[model samples]
Target: MSFVREDMNIVIVGHVDHGKSTIIGRLLADTNSLPEGKLEQVKERCRRNSKPFEYAFLLDALKDEQEQGITIDAARCFFKTDRRDYIIIDAPGHIEFLKNMVTGASRAEVALLVIDANEGIQENSRRHGYLLSMLGIKNVVVLINKMDLVDYSEEVFNKIVKEYTEFLNKIDVEPNQYIPVSGFFGENIVASSEKTPWYSGSSVLEVLDGFDKEKLPDDKPFRMPVQAVYKFTGDGDNRRIVAGTIETGRIKVGDEVVFYPSGKRNKINSIELFNAEIPESAGAGSAIGFTFDEQIYVKRGEVVTIAGQPKPKVGNRIKVNLFWLGRQSMVKGKEYLLKVGTAKVPVRIEEITKVIDASNLQNAVKESIDRHDVAECILIAQKPIAYDLAQDIAQTSRFVIVDNYEIAGGGIILKDLEDDSAWLRDKVILRNNKWENSNISREERAEKYGQKQALICITGQKDVGKKSIAKELERKLFNDGRIVYFLGISNVLYGVDADIKHTDNDSREEHLRRLSEVSNILVDSGAIPIVTAVELSKGDVEIIETAVDSDRIIKVWVGEEVTTDIEYDLHIPNYDSLEAAVSKVKTLLQDRGIIFKPF
Candidate 1:
């Protein structure tokens, strides 16, 4: 049996009033893609409203859009060429609907950026070009519209092309070709027009057909994020299924599979799919599930890969290129929900290295990324997530940020950042793999103690009452019948670091590592271990953070002013008395759901 190839998603984007909708309407009408009476119905409405007929009216199907003469959202229209089918996405050109345009264009394989030659390159003209480049749409066809308005002048078309070409160059984007056309008049749209005698190139329809189809990444290593584990025991089914779409490569029955971040291994027992006979194998793009031979634990955020193949980078920190579309500014210290593939995690912007004004491609020294601003920054996830660099694995690297439960921004992973304690983390991973497990699990210990485990680090300048508050807080929890302990920083220096010298930075890090290792054990024993260290910077705390899950650490700084980059969970800006400080810390613990309510 023969199957039609996958449809190519093409998006048309530009500034408001640049005639993006008109071009799409014209393409659909010219190609005979529109259903019967659809065109006449739109024209009849225009006639009844005492308005001149326009091709754009066909796509501005919404009543508000027709009244306002503006598209407020992205609309998908279907068309076909003899070679293959096409899904033409009509993305709004207004700046207010920039996010809507991104939502459409982000998934497109090719882009047709329309610029009104009469208006020249507007604000969104440059902005959209920069966005297409950022969205990884490498194949672009620049169409300079409204040539008829300029009397089809070659000089006018050439001027717009030169200016727009320079702008695209600033963003490192090279267009496939520059076509001068008039969507309203249907000049050089489906066929060559005599009005443009100086121009000689393939029509828009021809160029579109010439574009190559997107090839599936079968050669890349298999990557399937475990979305869910299914067990239909009540339905009389004994199979435990791992289900998700294969993003790249293939997996077959009996193949050795590894789930990342937790690093569990198993073999694919059988390929399972509804309404089909049992298949032995499946390739990329197959939305299927499988049963594993072993009862290994794999979570939703983990990626499944062939055991011996290339594995995705696993970490909590990443350098990203993002476009902010939130009404409020994307600021540091604010927690945002980041979703990449099937993995969702709470993330914070660690640092904004640079911000670029998309309108002019100029760099700005801004403290916060405002709406419509593009930026490069480092993002720290609450926990480690498995992913790949956008260049290496496009399917797994793109992500979205949800603010206020709405998609506020989108980004691509430029590179994976190594945590400060990467070397020590390697050792921790190896240690956990070889560590013995008892019948009592970690969750059981947490529930038995009636409190969550945490490495509560209290640090500040000398004589700022850091240790006093930590000790009092520990005493409070202990009196409340909760598992708690307080240890001083100097308590382990003489014993744990007897062989290492004070001047060696590596030895100092090792000392911190040992302290964290001990904290990890105490946490496993279901104790809230509070450790007091003097002036512990973010980098210093990172050592302890890697050995234990950072989520299990409660950071509190006791000082009038913070001296380090560490964003502590709780801060005592005014340490007037020990009792007040202890009360505040205890209240914070209660708020974090780490400590149960006291009687």
Candidate 2:
């Protein structure tokens, strides 16, 4: 495929009723990029509805959207100037549809944040600005719309521009251009408006025409998320090809690559896109496939990368900053689906550090994150997966949190807490020793208890039957004359002065923050062994394992089957009878060299 140098994506975003769609429609109309019949059809529909002709109606084609005069979803419109061919993404301006805005902005190389010159900056104006920053879109061009409403006065335009500029600066978005344009009047779009003669700046088209696409960061590390795998049988070739869009950097033939989380490495044999085996390399934005020398285990959502670059971390627990979009408030202890790149995984809010009040951009001590609130939170996924920080690479770093089929929030990974294993171990050991020494003399405890064993706690969804099996194992161990503390992790949190149940998203952080405190007490008590049951993901398991030093901890898997690198000392399948599970626990204890005595 021949590479097109002039291809660029641009998203238009702002507060609702700020003429985003109108501006896009005007641009397309002025540039004569719209198909011949499209505009006439839109005009006839407007006439039938008895509604006055609106430039926005040209793009707002959805039934509900036409009734409400609001853009609920991201809409795409294609156009071309003499300088470049552009794919314009019209993002929704409402705070309720911020997720849609993010979805649109994620695909664009540059963004045009539209603001009403008459109304000045609204809530979503600031919000869209913040979101663009979070989405890693640094090249912004502010469009001051509704210049006609303000009498096309230069003073009004300058004042609004100055105020909006200061606000953007506060959020760290340096706009490349601020154009004064009236989308409805078609002024200053393709040509300069006669009304604003004092405004000597270039027209919107001129600015877009002059944009330097070469300045975009294309030299980042190669990251191609496997969207799908193709295998052809009818064409006589029996080879499998991994296919996806190149998110960043470049990949060429014979380049050594690694599939993430799976940790499988292979060499690329050829790069193919639509019947062609390209010679050079594929840059960002190209959708292509490559066949590897060896048949490695490649799955959808797994990241493919060059050999020497820093690998994305594969972990269950992650720390992130989230922008909440759901109508209902976000609460802790609730499970949500996380979609990062192409992989969707079960996730929960382990903690909420702080909730940001969107109206004032100030920290609020709320119990949960409500609609339109931004928050800094820690999420715990059910399994280990590959991810990178947004700052390091936005392609792999950004993720969406989905609740009940709706995208409730969007976030970016600020940092990965997986590397704190060493510190966690030290804290666990120190706390364990402190409890052991404070509770009883070493000699006395040793004489009373034959051996000291660490506790492993598990927690997750209800109906998993965690408590039933925990009691049975405790009974078997106690009958064997071995001291075992079979405590419900929730009971330890509530009954033993530790807080664990998080009702809302804000309090969820407190719940996770208390996990370490409770675990320390159990480990230090010097019980022969401690076993508590809770539903937890592999990522959380790794975190707790590292926190308490897994070498001394024995994690037993119950219920569903999962893949883990941790050496599980015991694996018990879900049983129909309690006695059967108890018997298995007894056998496991015997295997571990514990003597069973009947009372």
Candidate 3:
């Protein structure tokens, strides 16, 4: 099937009364891009109001904006040239609507920053330029509007260009092109203006057509923030699907996918769609669902990724460059909700490294971020969330801060700070050192139980029968008069690892650390602790080895295919026969002297 040309999203931003809306209105009227009767309806309304028709009236669609004679919201309009389609976002220019401007600019891949030639440059003009840079829009065209009012003076345009270029350069933004135009008179918009003999650049429409569309990042790693888990079994349908829109890369049936934060790995049983033929594969921009081979618990806010691909970072603390639009200054200690992808978590401003004045490129140290202030700060979320760095994958890196149920700020994550478990590790160290001893020595308990204390971990891929094997081994040891107990990872999740979450790298590490402590206590009581985990990595085993003596820990892998980088004491190809698998594990335990053979 033939697809339409990719539409380019471009934003027009500038100071109030700088002709942002006027330029868009004139572009629509001149290019015959407006809908039938739209321009006439606007002009007719102005005539009935006993006011002269102005090009700006074509936009300012909101009644409040028309009455106030300003654009208060980002007005989006669709237009097309012979080259491609364009969605022009007319961002508000008023200082009060700076937040609206940011919302519009953040969606755009290219920008047109307007400045009045007569007024030279205004505060919002400089601020908008800086914000466009922070939003990662590199294709920018600066328009020197109202040139007719300045008598098309080349000198006036040059002076504004020189000053603004220097300001933008400081913010690491080099404008793509600069053009002099008169939006009210419709000169240098659709066609070149005869009035400006000195200006040699292309007209606004030509410059717009020259801007390239943002490429779809299907080549990158797959990323889909789980929107919902649907278990619609009302009509006796037994399908449970995980649904979300793919933000990048592609996925196919039978591909092993891993859910971030949770690290649950399962194979895609089938691609699910509504009233459509099942697709073998889907790429970026497809809103689809999938049924997994194994029934694993997956929740919304977890990022779905293909196995063996680069994983997203998971941490509670993040370094970001954000613009604050809250009425009150964003201060430290105040709680806010940070929304990234489908995840919303409570967050606080941990530190403000620098508060930037976008208008003049001035930097200052401040404890709070004032209204319309852009700052580099560290934010600490209540729970870890999965995200990519803006430099790597911009689609999943941007986030919004909601204050009092209002979107008060937006920004892109720069880096994931150190995991939240640094202090926890220290606490664990102190705990091990200061741990109390029982009246009966560990040697006495081992002699009484007639078995050596050991921690045996059964781990492999999902649905690999590690749990079944571990349980069977537990029963065999008990029947053989050995002191042994089976421990599932979920058992400690509610009691010991209850304070932290189950997902994310740091929380997962902390969870394993606590599990290690529990295993240590069980072993100290001279009982064999058999733990079953899913996809235990080398690092996970090391965490357990820290608490329990490495010599007393045994790792076993049970699967047809090995997916983790863990060296195991024994590898059972599959659990085709449960008793056979259990026998192999018991033999390994007996050979290792964890359990004594019949005397």
Model 2 spans > 4 angstroms off = 1-5, 40-51, 61-65, 214-218, 230-238, 278-280, 419-599
Per-residue C-alpha lDDT of model 1 across residues 1-599, encoded as one tens digit per residue: 99857579899999888888888888888888988888899889878989999998877763237777788778888888787788988788878788888889987989999999888889899889988988889889999999888899999999998898888888889999999999999999988899999998988988999998878778899999988988666766656788999999988899988776656677899998888988999999888998977554356777888988998888889999999999999999999999988989889999999999899978888789999999999999876788999899888988899999988999889999987556776776566545555556555677788888777999888888888788888888889998988877677777766677867866878988888888888887789899988788876777786677677888989889788878788888886688889988888888888888656
Give me the candidate number with maximum TM-score: 1
Question: Cα RMSD to native, each candidate?
Answer: 6.0, 13.3, 15.5
The lDDT per prediction is: 0.85, 0.74, 0.85
Q: What's the TM-score of each model vs. the native? A: 0.75, 0.69, 0.71
| Rank ordering of all candidates by lDDT, starting from the highest | 3, 1, 2
Ranking by TM-score: 1, 3, 2
User: Model 3, range 1-599, lDDT digits (tens) per residue?
Assistant: 99788688899999988888889988888888888898889889988999888888887653346777888888778887888888888888888888888889887888999999988888888889888887888899999999999899999999999998888888888988999999999989999999999999999999888876777779999999999988755777767799999999999999988776655677899998889999999988899999977555467888999988998987788999998888989999988999999988889999999998877778899989998789999999866678999999888999999999989998999998995443554454456435555656454576788888899999888888888888988898899888889988889998877888666565777888889889988987889999988888866776675567667899999887889878899999866699999989888988987777655
Query: Model 1 — which ten-residue stretch has the worst lDDT?
Result: 433-442
For residues 1-599, could you state the per-residue lDDT of candidate 2 as single tens digits? 99775878899999888998899888877788887887788889878988788777777762237777788888777889877899988788877778888899988888998989889888888888888877878789998999999898889888988887787777678999998999999988999889788888999888888777744345998888899987665766756789998888888888888776545677899888886657567888788998877554356977888888777776677899889899888888888999888888888887889988664577876768898888998887765567888778877899998989998888898877753343443443344323322435333443576644456454334566657777866776677666677655565457643443445645432344356455645655556444453455554566564344344455666666634543456766577787886676566555554433334
- Each candidate: how many clashes? 0, 12, 2
